[model samples]
Target: MMMTGSALTDEAAEAETLVHSTKTDKPRRIAILSYRSTPHVGGQGIYLDYLSRALVERGHDVDIISGPPYPEVDERVKVIEIPSLDLYAQPHNGHFALRPRHFKRGEDLYEYFAHLTGKFAEPLTFGERLKRYFAEQKPQYDVIIDNQTLTPGLLSDALQKTPIIGIIHHPITQDRQLALDAEKSFRKRLLIRRWYGFIAPQIKVACQMPIHITSSGAIKKDIMREFGLKSEQLRVIPLGVAQEDFHPRDDVKREPLQIITTASADVPLKGLIYLLRAVAKLRDDLPDLKLKVIGKLREGATSKELEALSISDMVSFESGLTREELARAFCAASIAVTPSLYEGFGLPCAEAMSCGTPVLTTDGGALPEVVGDAGLVVPKADPEALATALRTFFKQSDELKAELGRRAFERAQLTFNWSRIAPVYETVIEEAIAR
Candidate 1:
């Protein structure tokens, strides 16, 4: 009771050290690998950013090794940059242009040539660099989590020091099928097949992996079926949203007639074409309706569809928004829609729900699992069904919309928050280390 200030300070320091030591005793060293991890580019980057941060929060050291379009990771998470040709960043025809120095390295030469021939070779090239880095640096990690890269170089003798778990966010087979279905011309089909040639290597590496992690049961099933993996070899861990960052802001007023969707415009699997058709069908009845798309607007089938419907004026496109901007966009919208042909995990659906926005999504891949009963579900690739669902919502009263929003928010908080999901990842890593 009569202890001096110095004595009290010493006691507090000792208690802190004890707690830190206890947590550190079984703390793991984790390496998360990604070929292209630009956060705004796609879901894979977002997964890497959030998962690494969550793991670090749980008292593990996480290092992210990524190629160009590097991820914006937390300061606590170290990022190991792996340089590549990064042809995608080149302007105009620069992607096809090559320098004399590129011919020096086999990996760089392969990447440039692959791009010249309309093939995607980042995974292969990144893996080559990763294996080289491991051979030279010999970095120590308890487990290496490959974020859907599935490159053959990962299996090289240089990287056999640690257990590697591959994450297959659904199979690239689905994407190939959708892309092929979208095109009818013989030349186009041939080019599509050429671009997706990487799938073969992916399948080979996935089959070789001892353990695979997926985001949902749907994705696990696809991986098992496509890669011929056994049930026990796969682990399902659902992804999490930044609940605190995505939550509804009371100060932001929702636009009663505004609708938002986060689908890549040119990607056939994203089903943006169907969504555009649905919006066109609703244009007659809801004259004030406006749709905002969070993706790049490129010349493709999406553009043709918009032009054919003559509803281009009613839709606006915004790309590369910061996380805060995206959250605010969700909160300000009356409805958030996800009209994908398939998804390994419908991240935008969960994010919109976390922002207290009512959702309408197609029953594609894991959309039903992620949205549950909190959002409306329609058939995949059916524009009429999506239109009907949106019409029903437009006819509903504000009270019903508000109730749906509340349920969506609650569902997201209970199921998709990082705090709830990080422990599952921790357990998986521990099991890998144990093996």
Candidate 2:
């Protein structure tokens, strides 16, 4: 059941139940800090938004502290907005600096330059805001957990001592390595690496924290190896999917010979290029096959690859969709693919499965761990293997279609509902406070 109180209380209770609970006091206060929330941009934010709301449902108080691309939260949960220059707010065309976001000492300019230089600045800026917030008014919250804003400033600043915990979604190091491998030019690789350099502070800070948490052990392993951290330092907690929102839709028509994918269409780390090539190869065998992408199309290497492959005509791009529209897309899809080079948690794969759509995922980081036996698995950056899998799905359509969908639906129900997840988070909050 969905928690009715707040993220802190709900997850705290869930955590307690997972192990063994001896405490009688219910957790009252919770703080979840993140750089950006989703629907404003990506899945991380959506994860925070829904999970927080679910927590609130379970009778806990939740406050989300976030930077640019703020979260869309329920009225019950308090949102502490930490506004940045937000250069990447929307359509950041050439004339951004003079837009006048007023600066005490030109924090906006520094951020804009950082973006231009491919250096991520949100963690640093958010750290400054958080430090200021704590300095101005310190509240006696039961627990304070950061949602993947692993910057050193949060740990180093005076804000470090307040029953703090870190919620690392997953380390971004795997994304960096995949990107560097995908880069066509040495200069491109260098720029990508530079952008990822922002994670250094996160690595440094994880060492000192009493509680460090992640969504999956797959992710925990990755973070430990990449961040030079120890496995014992982290607590693994898997997040749940929103079954009601993601489940099968009988109203929507499932297009035959159609496939769907949800991710940034432009990012190289997502392996959109690999998917596109696979689609092209499969289209030759299944001549009427088509692909629909649910992410914004960008002018990047992946997009360029799509154009070069001559399969641009076969693919449909749609962005800026509400959750309902996205669900409709999932319902209409015959098969869903997650061709990422790496992932900490593959939300889309689970979401699609919840919608009763069969999934095919690449062995990119934690994707296989997430997909398990419910979906087909393939190698990363391999068009031939993907094409073969797609062809098999179509060739055995009648025999495997509903069977695959049924298995997927069952898996999603057992593992992904938000009601089930929110309480677990509540438990973690209590555990953190106890620590």
Candidate 3:
């Protein structure tokens, strides 16, 4: 039974797909918990989207139990939406404030009052809702993955029996500290502290979890230091990028002197201020250079910095872009940069790399780990260093830039592909289930 060449090729392709797939020998029921999943914003939502898709591809039944701004996932992945006050989306005036119906539930009352007093209570309220939902639904699962919502409700008696894997995406304490460091007024700092009060419960819950996961060793250390977790309880699994959505667009021509980056919030951790400073310094060197920020320009320190630097005209921002649109933006840029002061996994850096765009990121948190030797790295929070690196990068010949882009794409494919990373996660899940 000798097969023709095309038939043999088809057989080989089938074998390759099987080998590369994350399919498991025994399929299990899995539930992923996320408090807030803002779609495409590249935090909890992006994590849920890719993980659930990969798990379903691997022959697992996955249910994403999430709060408002529910994640967009594969058709095979069931999404169980848990409603929240979502106060941030609502007006805080007394007229639109608490209603008689809100008083029906203590959680709702607390959420309304907490937000009224300038405290961020979504995490706590979300946890309450999650616990109630679990009790009512009584959904059975082989394992549960908590996506950084280290709320005390997760430890309720109903869920205590199941094997729950908690993932701390870089301790929220880092976010708290960064916010505190960015503000000078004592009153503002106090408010920031109050806003981050959930950290206390998060730390408490994290210590009780049997197993925890983080995206990088850098973040694992931070979690260990911040949450008082031992090394044995933690596993480092690198996050995955959507290869199909983020790959290079050969049809799009890269524009010289055009730089692109993703900085959703104008926070100190994002280090956008430093990038703005670097861009200001490079204005004379590269007169026509343009910076494309994939985020909104809100009224904050970043806006002030842009005005102070007088480079607001040269800088433009775009938000709410589709995955394909973002990929095209990455492909059209000369290079992508992530100047974050710290990142748990540096997903944007990986996304840019997947688009075949050479990256220039800081040695912040896991940015160096994500970049590896594929692109360039500069000292975090150093605008002069960024300027120097950009100068050097711009000096490289077109051939060199193309080679760098190729290396970045290759590294992303090898290191951050979901098909490869999902199996690692599956092993962790299976281990927890066995325990």
Listed per model in order, the count of residue pairs whose N, CA or C atoms clash below 3 Å is 0, 26, 0
Model 1 lDDT tens row, 208-326: 78788777776677778887888788877778897768999998999988999997547999999899999999999998899999998998788888899999899999998989999
Candidate 3's TM-score reads: 0.93
TM agreement with the true structure for every prediction: 0.93, 0.90, 0.93
Worst lDDT 10-window in candidate 3: 1-10
At residue 116, give the lDDT of candidate 3: 75
lDDT of 2 by residue, 314-428 (tens): 9988888877888889899899998887777778888898899988888776676666667788887787788888887888856588788887788778656766666566666
**Weakest ten-residue segment in model 2 by summed lDDT:** 1-10
Q: Candidate 2 — what's its lDDT? A: 0.74
Candidate with more favorable, higher lDDT: 1 or 2: 1
Q: List runs of model 1 lying over 4 Å from the truth.
A: 1-25, 93-96
TM-score-wise, the better of 2 and 3 is 3
What is the Cα root-mean-square deviation between model 1 and the actual structure?
10.1
lDDT comparing candidate 1 with the true structure? 0.85
